[model samples]
Target: MHRQYVVNLSRIREVERRFKGELFLVMDDQEQTMVPVSRRNAPAVRRALQI
Candidate 1:
Protein backbone atom coordinates (compact mmCIF):
# COMPACT_ATOMS: atom_id res chain seq x y z
CA MET A 1 0.00 0.00 0.00
CA HIS A 2 1.03 3.56 -0.62
CA ARG A 3 0.98 5.97 2.29
CA GLN A 4 1.02 9.73 2.07
CA TYR A 5 2.65 11.88 4.71
CA VAL A 6 2.60 15.57 5.51
CA VAL A 7 5.98 16.85 6.55
CA ASN A 8 6.05 20.38 7.88
CA LEU A 9 8.24 22.97 6.19
CA SER A 10 9.87 23.75 9.51
CA ARG A 11 11.01 20.18 9.79
CA ILE A 12 12.35 20.39 6.28
CA ARG A 13 14.38 23.47 7.10
CA GLU A 14 15.60 21.89 10.30
CA VAL A 15 17.46 19.36 8.20
CA GLU A 16 18.28 21.61 5.23
CA ARG A 17 21.87 21.90 6.39
CA ARG A 18 22.26 18.24 5.52
CA PHE A 19 20.98 18.59 1.99
CA LYS A 20 22.68 16.25 -0.44
CA GLY A 21 22.58 16.71 -4.18
CA GLU A 22 19.00 17.52 -5.10
CA LEU A 23 17.55 15.52 -2.24
CA PHE A 24 16.98 16.45 1.37
CA LEU A 25 15.95 14.59 4.49
CA VAL A 26 12.62 15.09 6.18
CA MET A 27 11.27 13.59 9.37
CA ASP A 28 7.56 13.29 9.41
CA ASP A 29 5.43 12.29 12.37
CA GLN A 30 6.32 8.67 11.79
CA GLU A 31 9.51 8.27 9.79
CA GLN A 32 12.24 9.88 7.79
CA THR A 33 12.39 10.10 4.02
CA MET A 34 14.46 11.75 1.35
CA VAL A 35 12.69 14.22 -0.85
CA PRO A 36 13.79 14.84 -4.40
CA VAL A 37 12.50 18.30 -5.05
CA SER A 38 12.14 18.84 -8.75
CA ARG A 39 13.40 21.94 -10.50
CA ARG A 40 9.90 23.23 -10.86
CA ASN A 41 9.27 22.94 -7.16
CA ALA A 42 12.76 23.78 -6.08
CA PRO A 43 12.09 27.49 -5.94
CA ALA A 44 9.00 27.06 -3.83
CA VAL A 45 10.71 24.61 -1.55
CA ARG A 46 13.67 26.89 -1.11
CA ARG A 47 11.44 29.84 -0.43
CA ALA A 48 9.38 27.89 2.04
CA LEU A 49 12.37 26.41 3.79
CA GLN A 50 14.30 29.68 3.45
CA ILE A 51 17.25 27.79 2.12
Candidate 2:
Protein backbone atom coordinates (compact mmCIF):
# COMPACT_ATOMS: atom_id res chain seq x y z
CA MET A 1 0.00 0.00 0.00
CA HIS A 2 1.00 3.56 -0.60
CA ARG A 3 0.35 6.64 1.45
CA GLN A 4 -0.08 10.27 0.44
CA TYR A 5 -0.14 13.54 2.33
CA VAL A 6 -1.38 17.03 1.61
CA VAL A 7 0.55 20.14 2.59
CA ASN A 8 -0.75 23.67 2.63
CA LEU A 9 0.83 26.56 0.71
CA SER A 10 1.74 28.27 3.98
CA ARG A 11 3.81 25.28 4.92
CA ILE A 12 5.49 25.42 1.56
CA ARG A 13 6.47 28.99 2.22
CA GLU A 14 7.95 27.95 5.54
CA VAL A 15 10.01 25.32 3.78
CA GLU A 16 11.11 27.86 1.21
CA ARG A 17 12.24 30.16 3.97
CA ARG A 18 14.15 27.34 5.64
CA PHE A 19 15.89 26.68 2.35
CA LYS A 20 16.59 30.35 1.79
CA GLY A 21 13.88 30.85 -0.86
CA GLU A 22 14.59 27.67 -2.79
CA LEU A 23 11.41 25.76 -3.53
CA PHE A 24 12.28 23.68 -6.54
CA LEU A 25 12.03 20.51 -4.47
CA VAL A 26 11.74 21.11 -0.77
CA MET A 27 11.19 18.99 2.33
CA ASP A 28 8.39 20.54 4.29
CA ASP A 29 8.71 20.76 8.04
CA GLN A 30 5.53 18.83 8.79
CA GLU A 31 6.55 15.81 6.80
CA GLN A 32 10.27 16.26 6.68
CA THR A 33 10.03 14.42 3.38
CA MET A 34 11.03 15.36 -0.13
CA VAL A 35 8.63 14.83 -3.00
CA PRO A 36 9.67 15.22 -6.61
CA VAL A 37 7.99 18.03 -8.50
CA SER A 38 7.34 17.13 -12.10
CA ARG A 39 8.47 19.38 -14.91
CA ARG A 40 4.87 19.79 -16.07
CA ASN A 41 3.77 21.01 -12.65
CA ALA A 42 6.81 23.13 -11.92
CA PRO A 43 5.43 26.26 -13.49
CA ALA A 44 2.04 25.87 -11.84
CA VAL A 45 3.65 25.26 -8.49
CA ARG A 46 5.80 28.33 -8.83
CA ARG A 47 2.85 30.42 -9.81
CA ALA A 48 0.70 29.18 -6.98
CA LEU A 49 3.44 29.69 -4.45
CA GLN A 50 4.35 33.03 -5.96
CA ILE A 51 7.99 32.07 -5.86
Candidate 3:
Protein backbone atom coordinates (compact mmCIF):
# COMPACT_ATOMS: atom_id res chain seq x y z
CA MET A 1 0.00 0.00 0.00
CA HIS A 2 1.01 3.60 -0.57
CA ARG A 3 0.11 6.89 1.00
CA GLN A 4 0.41 10.43 -0.27
CA TYR A 5 0.93 13.53 1.84
CA VAL A 6 -0.12 16.98 0.72
CA VAL A 7 1.39 20.25 1.88
CA ASN A 8 -0.64 23.39 1.90
CA LEU A 9 0.49 26.08 -0.53
CA SER A 10 0.43 28.55 2.30
CA ARG A 11 3.42 26.79 3.85
CA ILE A 12 5.77 27.70 1.02
CA ARG A 13 8.57 29.81 2.47
CA GLU A 14 10.94 30.35 -0.43
CA VAL A 15 11.15 29.79 -4.18
CA GLU A 16 14.68 29.35 -5.47
CA ARG A 17 15.61 29.42 -9.13
CA ARG A 18 17.88 26.56 -10.13
CA PHE A 19 20.07 25.84 -13.16
CA LYS A 20 18.51 25.86 -16.63
CA GLY A 21 15.51 27.82 -15.31
CA GLU A 22 14.39 25.14 -12.92
CA LEU A 23 12.87 26.03 -9.57
CA PHE A 24 12.87 24.75 -5.98
CA LEU A 25 10.12 25.49 -3.56
CA VAL A 26 11.00 25.31 0.13
CA MET A 27 8.12 24.39 2.35
CA ASP A 28 8.30 25.58 5.96
CA ASP A 29 7.29 22.32 7.47
CA GLN A 30 8.75 19.83 9.92
CA GLU A 31 10.87 18.29 7.15
CA GLN A 32 11.36 21.40 5.02
CA THR A 33 11.63 19.50 1.78
CA MET A 34 12.46 21.23 -1.48
CA VAL A 35 10.08 20.52 -4.33
CA PRO A 36 11.51 20.96 -7.80
CA VAL A 37 9.60 22.64 -10.57
CA SER A 38 10.51 22.03 -14.18
CA ARG A 39 11.58 24.90 -16.42
CA ARG A 40 8.58 24.47 -18.69
CA ASN A 41 6.22 24.58 -15.73
CA ALA A 42 7.89 27.51 -13.95
CA PRO A 43 5.53 30.09 -15.38
CA ALA A 44 2.40 28.27 -14.36
CA VAL A 45 3.81 27.47 -10.93
CA ARG A 46 4.77 31.07 -10.34
CA ARG A 47 1.35 32.20 -11.46
CA ALA A 48 -0.26 29.85 -8.98
CA LEU A 49 2.04 31.04 -6.17
CA GLN A 50 1.46 34.64 -7.27
CA ILE A 51 5.14 35.38 -6.88
Candidate 4:
Protein backbone atom coordinates (compact mmCIF):
# COMPACT_ATOMS: atom_id res chain seq x y z
CA MET A 1 0.00 0.00 0.00
CA HIS A 2 1.02 3.62 -0.57
CA ARG A 3 2.25 5.92 2.16
CA GLN A 4 -0.51 7.77 4.01
CA TYR A 5 0.33 11.19 2.57
CA VAL A 6 0.86 9.79 -0.93
CA VAL A 7 -2.72 8.63 -1.00
CA ASN A 8 -4.93 11.36 0.45
CA LEU A 9 -4.08 14.86 -0.71
CA SER A 10 -7.51 16.28 -1.26
CA ARG A 11 -8.73 15.23 2.12
CA ILE A 12 -5.55 16.69 3.56
CA ARG A 13 -6.07 19.97 1.73
CA GLU A 14 -9.65 20.24 2.85
CA VAL A 15 -8.42 19.71 6.37
CA GLU A 16 -5.81 22.42 5.87
CA ARG A 17 -7.99 25.02 4.18
CA ARG A 18 -11.41 24.41 5.64
CA PHE A 19 -10.67 22.82 8.95
CA LYS A 20 -8.49 23.99 11.78
CA GLY A 21 -6.19 22.13 14.22
CA GLU A 22 -5.32 18.41 14.26
CA LEU A 23 -6.54 16.28 11.35
CA PHE A 24 -7.94 12.80 11.31
CA LEU A 25 -8.93 10.58 8.37
CA VAL A 26 -11.63 7.99 8.71
CA MET A 27 -11.27 5.92 5.58
CA ASP A 28 -14.04 3.55 4.62
CA ASP A 29 -11.46 0.92 3.82
CA GLN A 30 -9.52 1.23 7.05
CA GLU A 31 -11.92 1.42 9.87
CA GLN A 32 -10.42 2.25 13.29
CA THR A 33 -7.15 3.31 11.71
CA MET A 34 -5.38 6.58 12.47
CA VAL A 35 -3.20 8.57 10.08
CA PRO A 36 -1.26 11.28 11.82
CA VAL A 37 0.98 13.79 10.01
CA SER A 38 3.30 16.64 10.73
CA ARG A 39 1.95 20.19 10.63
CA ARG A 40 4.53 21.14 7.99
CA ASN A 41 3.43 18.35 5.65
CA ALA A 42 -0.24 19.15 6.00
CA PRO A 43 -0.37 21.55 3.03
CA ALA A 44 1.56 19.45 0.51
CA VAL A 45 -0.29 16.38 1.61
CA ARG A 46 -3.57 18.13 0.87
CA ARG A 47 -2.43 19.43 -2.53
CA ALA A 48 -1.25 16.02 -3.62
CA LEU A 49 -4.61 14.54 -2.81
CA GLN A 50 -6.28 17.02 -5.19
CA ILE A 51 -4.46 15.35 -8.08
lDDT of 1 by residue, 1-51 (tens): 012434566655234333444545465645666655554666666677666
**Candidate 2 lowest-lDDT run of ten:** 13-22
Q: Please give the RMSD of candidate 2 to the true structure.
A: 6.3
> After superposing candidate 2, which stretches have Cα over 4 Å from the reference?
1-5, 13-24
Q: Tens-digit lDDT track for model 4 on 1-51?
A: 124444443332223222455555444343544466566765665565552
TM-score of each predicted structure versus truth: 0.48, 0.50, 0.71, 0.43
Candidate 4 positional error at 47, Å: 0.4
Q: lDDT at 28 for candidate 3?
A: 95
Q: Per-residue error at 50 for model 4, in Å?
A: 1.7
Steric clash pairs (candidate 3): none
In angstroms, the error of model 3 at 27 is: 0.6
Model 4 TM-score relative to the real fold: 0.43
| Backbone N/Cα/C clashes per model | 0, 0, 0, 3
- Report the C-alpha displacement of residue 30, candidate 4, in angstroms: 5.0
Question: Number of clashing pairs, model 3?
Answer: 0
Best model per TM-score: 3
The deviation in Å at residue 43 for candidate 1 is 0.8
Q: Clashing pairs in model 1? A: none
**lDDT for position 19 in model 1:** 40
Which candidate tops lDDT? Answer: 3
Can you tell me which runs of candidate 1 are displaced by over 4 Å?
1-6, 13-21, 28-31
Backbone clashes in model 4, listed as residue pairs:
9-49, 10-49, 13-46
Per-residue error for 24 in candidate 1, Å, reads 2.7
